[model samples]
Target: MTFTRQGCLLVIAVALASPVLAEGPDPVRGAELFPIRCVECHVITDGAEKKIGPSLKGLIGRTSGTLEGYDYSDAMKTAGIVWSEQTLKTYLVAPRKMVPGTKMNFNGLKRPGEVEDVVAYLLEAGT
Candidate 1:
């Protein structure tokens, strides 16, 4: 086998880029799963304030710990996280591990499909 400088650079670039992969939820699936599991406590409407939990509008690109008027615990504040579809899915799967000592009481979702569905629902809701 022979390698050129350009080939080596391309391989290195691919190796470095492997850590960032794209993953987003299916909106249809999320819509179905959301009302069944999440709507009891949360709302996703724009301009809507805190429900039993804070409104989740515009969560895809929002900063993790900066929502106004909701009382967040120190655990979530200090997690050094940002909320994206990927982060939401990860947190929804295991909140305790993702942000220890936060007060969300629901058992973390165990199914990938359900998590995707919920995320999709959150992404498309109230818009």
Candidate 2:
């Protein structure tokens, strides 16, 4: 099939726009997973009491272990991480592997989808 100029342009435009149109991770699924997977250890609310882990409020822009009043392991405090979605995904895959000697005792969310969903939930909840 021969491509017309307008057809090529339209295809290019759609290709470029597809990513923006694509749905982001499902926060609903993340919400479902959070209580079962994270609430016992982490809380997403701001000003909430720190439980086994620090409150995750405003977590995306914050550096790891910088939250006030939460006692972080020295390794986590020194990891110098900025919590972006990508960084959080990596960390959730294997917390100890990412930050050796860290005190987050839970092994990790082994499934990528769960990690993604959790990240989505945390990001939304923190906001």
- Model 1 over residues 16-125: C-alpha lDDT tens digits? 66432224456776777777887888787777577677778877677666678778788877787877678888999988888888877777888646776676676666
lDDT of candidates 1 onward, in order:
0.74, 0.85
RMSD of each: 8.0, 6.6
State, as a TM-score between 0 and 1, how close model 2 is to the true structure. Answer: 0.78
Q: Candidate 2 residues 7-83, lDDT tens each? A: 99998897677652344577898899999998999888779578999998889889999999988999999999999
Task: Say which candidate scores most in lDDT.
Answer: 2
Q: Which runs in model 2 stand beyond 4 Å of their true positions?
A: 1-24
Winning candidate number (TM-score)? 2
TM-score of 1: 0.72
